[model samples]
Target: MINQSELENSKEVGIITDISDKELHLALGLSDPTCNNEISQQDQNESTHDTSNSTAPSEPQLFFQAVGLVRGQYLPSTEKLGSGILLLDDGVIAPTNLLASAVYTVKKHPNLLESPQVWIVYPRVQVKNPPFLNFAIRGARLPLEGEDAEVINQSVDDFSIRGIVTYTNRKAGNFVIKVYRNFMPWKEQEGTKYKPHIFTITGVLPSEGLPCGQFWDLKVKRVADQLVLEDATFITQVFEPKKPKKGRSKRQGQKRKAKRNQSNPQ
Candidate 1:
C-alpha cells in the first residue's frame, strides 16, 4: 500500500488526498464543492468586476473648450441673460446662451466680462418637454494668450462666415446659424483637401424674414441673451433637387420587348 504522504503528493497517478474541499473541487474540474456556492461565487466576482469597471454618467456639454467674450448682459428681477461670442479652440466664433445663475454671478463680478477669458459651462437638460437644454456658466478666468489663443484670435476680429440657417422661431424672434470658417493660412497643410471649421451661431431674427434652408450673411450684435441681427443679405437658396429617373439600358429594353411579345404573342 502507498504511504499516506506519497498519496497526498502523488503526481503521475493524479491522486489528491488530504486536500481541502475547495482544492478537491478544483482537482475534479468543479468550480466549488456545491453548485449553489459556485454560482454565488461567480455572481460575486461578476458583481465586483462590474462595480470596478462601471463609471458615473457625465454631465452634458453645451460648448467645446473655448474663450468667451462677454458683450451684453440683462439683469432683471426674475431672470438674467449673458450674451457673448465664444472664441472656440478650433478657430470658430459662435454665440453663447448663459444661464440666470451665471448672469447673476457675472453681474456681481463685472470684470469677468471686461476682457476675453476662458469660461466653464455646464449643460442642463429636462426629462420631459422641448427646449430642454440649458447652458449655465460655472466660472471664468483670463487666458495666458498663449500660441493657441493667439492663433484662434487671429481670425476672430475680422473674418467671413458662410453658414446655413438651421432654425427659426417666429414667436421667439430668434434663429440659429451653422457657420463655417476657414482655418488660419499657416495651419492649412499643402496637398491636403481643405476643410472649414464649423460652429453654431444663435441670434435674434432681423426684421426681414429668414426662411429655413436659405443661406445669408448676417450682421449681428450681442444683445440681451443672444446675438441680435442688425441686417441680413441673402446669399442663395439650398435645396435637394429632385433626381431624374434613370432610363432603361439597351439589354433591359430588349428583355422588356421579349416579355411583351411573349405575353401578347402578336
Candidate 2:
C-alpha cells in the first residue's frame, strides 16, 4: 500500500518538458482495452438481487513511475535518507510523505488558453503504493508564478486536473502510474524560462490527505474510474514551491557527492 504518512519526506522526480493528456492516459493504463466481463451467473444474480450492496470492487495494485524506471538507485526525503520507504505520509495534517524540494517541469495546453494553463513546476512525488492511496487526479493546473494558487482570499477559481492511468499491473504485486493528463507540450516548454516561486499547498487542499484543503470543501473524484482509495481525512502539506536559488558556478553544481553527503548526515 502507498504509505499515507510520509508525503513530506518522499523522493521526487522532475521532467523538464511538457506532456499531453492522451499520452498521460495511455501511460496511466486508463486506456487499457481489456475488460473482465466474465462473471458467474449465480454471482450476477446475487448482485442484481441486492441493490444496497456497499461492497467495493477489488482495488488494483499500483506501481510508481520512479521505482519502475529507476534501477539499483535510491530515493531521498527530508526526514531520512531512504528510510521507512513504505511508511509514506498522505500529505495531510503534516507533510510527512511528499517531496521536501524539487524542480519539475510543467505547462498548460494552448486550447485551454483563457484558463491559466500552468505547468506544474515542482517535484513530482512518485506514489510507491496505490492501494494505500486513493482518488488520484492529474492535469489540474496549479496557478503559475505571480498567479496565486491560494484557495483562500478568493485567490483563483476552483480548478480540475487531468489524470491518465498509465500502468496497472494489479497482479498482487503490480502497481500503476497515473500520468499528468494531456502532458505533451511539456516537451515544448523546455527552456521556456520563467521565475521560480514558492508553492505552498496545505494538506487539507488535497482530498487524500488528512484535514485536506477545506478552502471550498473540494470534492475529489477519480477522473477515469470510480475505484476510490481509502476515504479518510487528515491535514498535511503536499508541495510547497519556493523561488529557485540563483545558479551556482559549475564548481558548485559539480560539488562531490561526498561533500553533499557530509551535510546530509550518516
Candidate 1 C-alpha lDDT tens digits along 1-266: 22333223212111111233343233223334333322355655675556342111121111112223332222222333465544443334444556676666677887765555555543222324433332345555334556465553432222233444544545434554543221122233444443322223354444354355455666543333234455666665442112223456688899999999999985
Candidate 2, residue 14: Cα displacement in angstroms equals: 25
Instruction: Please give the lDDT score at residue 187 for candidate 2.
Output: 29
lDDT of 2 by residue, 1-266 (tens): 32322222222211112333333234334332122334577876786676442222121222111111100111224565312122112222111121222111112232432322222121223234433222111223444578754532132222222222211112222222232321122123434433211111212222232221111211232212112231212222222222223445566666776688889997
Q: lDDT of model 2 at residue 160?
A: 25
Total clashes for model 2? 66
Off by over 4 Å in 2: 1-91, 96-162, 173-175, 181-266
Whole-model Cα lDDT per candidate? 0.41, 0.26
lDDT of 2: 0.26
Task: List the candidates' TM-scores in order.
Answer: 0.26, 0.18
The per-residue C-alpha lDDT of model 2 at residue 86 equals: 23
